[model samples]
Target: MNDETSGKASIRRELLASRALLTSRDVEDAAAALAASALELPELAGARTVAAYVSVGREPGTRALLDTLRARGVRVLLPVLLPDNDLDWAAYAGPEHLAPAGRGLREPDGPRLGPAAVLDADAVLLPGLAVDGRGMRLGRGGGSYDRVLARLAAAGRHPALVVLLYGNEVVARVPEEPHDHPVDAVVTPAGTRRFG
Candidate 1:
């Protein structure tokens, strides 16, 4: 692997370890706080359509935020992981509609929309291990969001890109590769930070 890739792997290892240490209560509280903080962001308020995801395992929970947005009449979309690690989307009806998918992830059971559906979103909530001060994001190495971002760019769409994480995940730096796209904002339990 390249030096930047190696560096990111090392950092991800440490971050994952620390995140795994958080208790279930910690994750639950952070989920509520994250929803409150993110709901206040203008991007979400103004968005008519949002592409989001389900928070499984120890990742910063998105359930509260997802439900809140849906309650407010925003059309929320969730990712359906394709076999190749690219994402196809489906409308999120409610938590009841989610079924356990592969890799311990939860996905909407609604009709599948083509992967290109993300291009129609006004905003996208991404999952990541960390994002640097400059907004460069370190994803989980799945390359799913990478493909999403690339598709958005290819289609000339510039939806507000956001990542929800713990405060410490908003770090000083993360190795940036050519395919890495900078997020427009980062929302943590603490607050939200925006970038160019």
Candidate 2:
């Protein structure tokens, strides 16, 4: 593998291993802290509709944040993984309405909105293994969020791009490619980091 590919693989392995060490109580506390930190962001506060994802396994939990958004009556959109690895969004009804989807993901069981539905969001919460100081995100190498970012650029939409990760995942640098897009901010259990 090339340097870029190998570098990303190394980082992903390290981060996932660290996450695997967390206990159930740690995850629960981190989830609550993450939600509080994210809610304080002005972008999220002013957003009418936001695009977000679910946290599976040991990933930084988004459940608390999603529930808070729904409780506050803000429109929340959750992604449905398309067969092509692209994301199709759907309105979040609640935890009760989520069904077990492929890939250990839970998606909202409601009418499907086309992938372009992301264009309507004022903020987007991304899932990633890590993010660098320059706001360049290191995703799971799934090529999913990369396409989402490219689509947003094509539509001339500049919504607040945010990634939710663990505290240590905010690192010094991350490998980047030509197609990679910089995020505007990140929310971790510790606090929030803003870039640009």
Candidate 3:
């Protein structure tokens, strides 16, 4: 790995280790707060459709926000992980519609809408370990969302890219690569930060 790649790996490990220390209660409280904070963003409030994902493990929870969006008559799209690590989307009906998947993920059990479906979203809630001051996000290095971002760009669709994270996950900087795209905003338990 190059310096940028190794640096990202180190930072990811440290952030994940901190997340592992969170108690179940801590995760729950953060989830509620995250939803509240994220809901207040203009990007979400005005969005007709949102592309999102279900949180697994200690990652900052998105369930509450996803449900609220669906409740608001907003069409919520959840991801289905393809074997190649690219994501396919499906409409999120409710909690009952999510089924267990590999890597401890919970994916929507509805019909696959194919990967390009994300282009129809007005906003996308991304899962990440951390985001930097520059709005660059540090994902799990899976490259799935990277593909999603690329697809959106290729189609000239510029949805509001947002990341839901804990307050501490917003850092001064993160290792960035050429293919890495900056997010429009990040919602933490504390509040939301927007970038240009």
Clashes per model (N, Cα, C within 3 A):
0, 0, 0
For 123-183, candidate 3 gives per-residue lDDT tens digits of 9999999999999999999999999999999999999999999999999999999999999
Instruction: Decide which is better by TM-score, 2 or 3.
Output: 3
* Per-residue lDDT of model 2, residues 83-172, tens digit only: 999999999999999999999999999999999999999999999999999999999998999999999999999999999998999999
Per-model TM against the reference: 0.99, 0.98, 0.99
Give the CA lDDT, 0 to 100, for residue 51 in model 1: 99
Q: Per-residue lDDT tens digits of candidate 1, residues 20-86?
A: 8999999999999999999999999999999999999899999989999999999999999999999
> In model 2, where is the ten-residue run with the lowest total lDDT?
1-10
Q: Which residue pairs overlap in candidate 2's backbone?
A: none
Can you tell me which runs of candidate 3 are displaced by over 4 Å? none
lDDT of each: 0.95, 0.94, 0.95
In candidate 2, how many clashes are counted? Answer: 0
> Which pairs of residues clash in candidate 1, taking residues 3 or more apart in a chain or in different chains?
none
Q: Tell me the lDDT of model 1 at 112.
A: 98
